[model samples]
Target: MDEIKFICECCGKEHESWPAITYNSPSSYSNLSDQEKEEIAVIDSDFCVIKHSDQVDRFIRCVLIQKVNDHCEDLEYGFWVSLSEQSFENYLENFDNENHETQYFGWLSNYIPQYQFTNSIPTTVVTKNGNERPEIFPHQDFDHPFVKDYYNGITKEEAEKRIKKILKN
Candidate 1:
């Protein structure tokens, strides 16, 4: 149980230390008692834990925090779950339409060999090395006929006019 500190490398700001909870721990989800489960269910939260009675079955659970893909500044305590490598791989492979998971899977592929059940969840921050930012919105809708006409030739003046119209409204 080492102390964990998060420092903003750019601004040199020290974030407040939170309770050291990891995805892999005895206190983590699935391992929680029935009472704990009820407590969590009452509050509608998810978490990672293994049933102590079933530890021999070789499975790990996780309650992934909700903002796992967003800016670290907005994260808070989240629920957990138990997952198997095969199941996790399948999840990465079978994500339906959520681009955020797709983005995470892409990022995780390079580190697949180092994947571990007990590892701390990683957080992202803007840094000097400039990692690509995640797509924050859906692809631009181009259903209008005007979009095709304007696609490659959106002039600076037109863009400014559009912005002025939007701001004025």
Candidate 2:
């Protein structure tokens, strides 16, 4: 796998090399009891924030896997990461020039492909584990055919326009 360097947005720590998965074990949630688990929903869940590069904002990924038949569509609910409010504002401020904007947004377009995307926004839900589930709102990801088409060939201006349309709703 290709490696990328980035500054940790959550910890402000600089990391060099490729991104890797850091798993937190089940013991991480061992302290929660049945009542607490009901209040939270999940058990032994872990959270991670993905920072693709120095220039790109962090993409948070928090998830857990276990066997359960519930209202959830899958065994796990995933949170797609995005820019923080302040970081998004900064991104907009630099979007006038496609070249400059692409440096940031291009990374976004490419980093998130048309797959692994959902219409849901990031939200907080108490899990059985006594932890809050990380949420992701609707947006284009590598999974969307339109978004895949857009990232594959569309220019920055065109991509921005499409993104704007999605944001309006």
Candidate 3:
């Protein structure tokens, strides 16, 4: 992992090292107005919830590893996915159990700027033991550039460009 650093918006505290490129919240939650957020949405490092128009949307923060074909280090993203109500409930129910492991269908809920039209890829969310955050895998048949990239991998220079684009550094 490279020495990527950022200050937290909430605490204004500097973090020393961030191994994976990260997104703080799902795009759906970020899209809500301040008022709507105040009334209906809540998020932390691992989960997010929004209630609006009489429907509830739940999201979980997950990791996606993207291969960098020419580099020793792979690019990783801390992204989110929207879960079905039952799936969401199942996840929440086992949130604290280190022994729990399962999989659920999800929709990718964040934007990856390197690729246009990157959101809402059909995904499988995998929960691992020891209570780590879930990981997501894009469905193979999803006909999109992002999906292709996920499987085919990117060049090291392309990977660095993406990191710079995200970090603005």
Candidate 4:
């Protein structure tokens, strides 16, 4: 038997291992109104980036899915943003329609420190369009401060330092 370990880039700490990362788009995407679709930026099909408009605010939801031997599990992470229309359009223009497994990084409004071993923390979205389902991994929810540091543009080094200080006490 062997033990696996991963050095987290966000917190700069060693974790036992990371689970396979996956993303899932809500089935509601197809049902969105044409106007809604116009305001949305489809990211590799698995993610829909809704811009901040008078009708709706900007936000992102990332789903983490894991597959074990015969079972599958999942959880959701998300955040709201205030991106400008131009920025949102840029993202839409850059979207790769052919590959659905595209990875996008954004700020997180919620943080689940328990999954520190995750390949990437809250901000990483792994698109699931045009790809096979992802493998599942064991997951657990632990208690920690729900920090908005990611949204504040805190670097991984700073986050890791803060986490160490918190855990040290």
The best candidate in terms of lDDT: 3
After best superposition, candidate 3 residue 166: deviation in angstroms? 0.8
lDDT of each: 0.30, 0.34, 0.87, 0.37
Q: Candidate 3: deviation at residue 123, Å?
A: 0.3
Ranking 3 against 4 by TM-score, winner: 3
lDDT of 2 at 21: 22
Candidate 2 weakest ten by summed lDDT: 101-110
107: Cα error in model 2, Å: 11
Which 10 successive residues of model 3 have the least lDDT summed? 10-19
Q: Write the per-residue lDDT of candidate 3 for residues 64-141, one digit (tens) a residue.
A: 999988755678899999999999999999999999999999999998886677347999999999999999999999
**For candidate 3, what is the lDDT?**
0.87
Give the number of the best model, judged by TM-score: 3
- Model 4: residues >4 Å from true position, as ranges? 1-58, 66-91, 94-100, 110-122, 131-169
Residues 1-169, candidate 4: write the lDDT tens digits.
Answer: 1335767575677755423222233333435687766666453432345443444323334443322221122122222222235534444554555464444544332324333432322334444565432211111232222322222233434444443543454
The per-residue C-alpha lDDT of model 3 at residue 159 equals 82
RMSD of 2: 21.5
- Where in model 3 is the C-alpha error above 4 Å? 1-18
**Stretches of candidate 1 exceeding 4 Å from the true structure:** 1-6, 20-59, 68-169
> Which lDDT tens digits does candidate 2 get at residues 1-169?
3435667565576644322222232221334466644554342233222222343233333442222222111122243334464544554454343443221121121122323534423222212223233222223444555343423444444434433443443
* Candidate 2 segments whose C-alpha is farther than 4 A from its true place: 1-56, 63-80, 85-131, 140-169
Tens digits of per-residue lDDT, candidate 1, 28-135, equal 433457786665422122212233453521122222222222223322222132244454344434433244232221111001111233333332211111222222
Q: What is the lDDT of residue 53 in candidate 1?
A: 51
